[model samples]
Target: MNKPVLDINDFPSKTQLITLSFQHMFAMFGSTILVPQLVGLSPAIALLTSGIATIIFLFITQFKVPAYLGSSFAFITPILIATNFGENPGNAMIGAMAVGITYSLVSLVIWKAGYKWLMRLLPPIVVGPVIMVIGLALSGTAVDMAMNVNDEYSFLHFTAALVTLFAAIVFTVYFKNILSAMPILLGLIIGYIYSAIIGIIDFTAVKEAKWFAMPDFLLPGIHYEFNITSSILLAMVPIVLVTISEHIGHQLVLGKVVNRNYIKDPGLHRSIFADGLGTFVSALLGGPPKTTYGENIGVLAITRVYSVYVIFGAAVLAILFAFFGKAMALIQTIPTAVLGGISILLFGIIASSGLRMLVENKIDFGKNRNLVISSVILVIGIGGAALRFSETFAIEGMALAAIVGVILNLILPGREIVQDEDEIN
Candidate 1:
């Protein structure tokens, strides 16, 4: 079918905007679905919350920014940890949502202090390795789960998992157009089919599962268990910091795409507050906390459709699909191996996003201070080393990396300003 024509210069007409909006919704589907699937939550619930959160995001940001709120991959490890600690998936999500609100509150402080100060504390070099750590830390989980799709003790499953993972990475790096966007989903699909043909996938659940049913919507049932609360906070807070940093970078990207300085105009303070508000709303509804997703940023960058209204349109579509339980069940049938394959791309893309930050900033690698900082960050972050003070003060990986980076950037003396091609142009 021929697509309808779209006018780029003017605000998209109502019908045209509606169509384009669905494009955005489709664009976000894989990652949004990926999170809930990984966390053992109801896929329908994830979709519903994401749609609601995106709409909330649009409303809170005054529908000025072309960003959507969805499941943040950053929260996955924390969520997994919380689950391991016996936090119910829904409650864990609520805790994460609370942490997101905390993040936004912290950002308000940063924005109030002037961006120059915040930049001094979190230059590209510091942020790059911190983000790198986030990706490297999660790589193990991807490999482990991908392998477990078959025999727990068999080396063959491990080999297959590695192959699937490698395929996803290769596709993400080399594939073009639609394939690139769906590297993880495609890889998972292919891997699942291979597994099913080989008699590996246990589809008994799929057979027993109803064609349509009400999704489990677990409400927040807070328990004052210290370990659970601390564990959730420890896992959630680091990503929240990373998310805040990402928020600044993304807002800048949105401003450039929309040809307005959103960072300074409506101001980062207001935007962060809006993000917090969206997350809070998502939590109340038993969904994962919302964050400004980079995937949507890529969509905006490609389409050049800057109207916030289009995103609102997307939000509406997302919410509608959330209510369609039948469609949600169909998505669950996709094989785990295929999903693992897709994650290979998704995870690597996340890591590379960190690399791109440094490249764009022209962060110098030759300086001894720079090399030491980066090296320390990668080693500490990836190695899972933690500095323990009191029971509550101990932290690991991304959180640890972020804290060290900020401190080093501030305490260390060499501060040379390097202009980038983007900045110069």
Candidate 2:
């Protein structure tokens, strides 16, 4: 695939840029808004960070690729755990933001070291299982949330969630074009509509919500007096590991769309560091950590618009919207059941994506070593078994999965190692 011209000087006219920008914005709409809502973070902050992150990403990448950064769903489990430990939602936001900043700083070092070093240290063998565990770890939370929609524990709600989950999978797996690309969002929409028809949606919040209000921006403050330094670090490491994969994917997509391998041109290290910078900015402003949004990659793929300027325009619009009070209000007005219904799709995707990773990596589950690693990783992670060393060194779920997978990969050497060079390359 030939790379297209993407320099700002070579972009289409202003009118064309605005139109393209709107398309990019729409691409990000469902995923960006849903991340905050699903994770119990403020939608307003999410919107703002997304906008800011997009701009910063462009600046750091020198506007080389038409990409937009948005709230990362990867941090949802960590945020949820932090919240449980008595971190206020706002404080949790601060913690997550801090993590993003930390990631950004770490990314700089990784980027400078180049992609070879990254691939060497974190091979597919390690990354593949870690990803599977991430999904497994959070699976219970998905079911738990699904069952809690009615404010009462009911098998009916779980059934409803399962239905929503399956519907999303079907649509995403089989649907063509834009619909196929947005199965998670589409699933939520479909589920919400179904719930609404059943009279489960509460319109009171929507009705009472102001037309506009300033997105609540708070200074980053430390909370949760209990210091689980080790737990926080454990949570932080796995996040960084997976985020690096996400970073690579985003850059590769942009490179393919724009007709340039910016990963090799400006370098993957540069792009990762750029992503870190964007994350740092997002953290400062009290938004969920930002990453290059794959949704935007789909948008670029479909539109064939490679103009970075247009993407920058979209970023500005997001920042402007962040300042608007009414937009945030409308986001808040989204009902819990509606959100829960959407979550059924979102969290399920998180799990399914993991399965995709395993299959794509050609992980040999037939082998005893493979089976043991995969099985233990899945059970411990999904079952939410916590491993504690006093308190600071507690490991649970995704972090546990990552560690277990790495350890198993090293310890249980495959007897029949059929290396799939194609996937590995």
Quote each prediction's TM-score: 0.83, 0.84
How many clashes would you count in candidate 2? 10
lDDT of 1 by residue, 7-60 (tens): 223568878788878877877777788887877766777777787877766666
Q: Residue 18 of candidate 2: its Cα lDDT?
A: 81
Off by over 4 Å in 2: 2-9, 85-87, 153-175, 186-197, 222-228, 366-369, 410-425
Which pairs clash in the backbone of model 2?
A: 3-259, 4-259, 104-276, 111-269, 137-381, 211-326, 212-325, 212-326, 213-325, 213-326
Q: For residues 173-240, could you state the per-residue lDDT of candidate 2 as single tens digits?
A: 78667666566666666666666666555567666766666776645544323333555656555667
Model 2 CA lDDT for position 183:
64
The Cα error of candidate 2 at residue 230, in Å, is 3.7
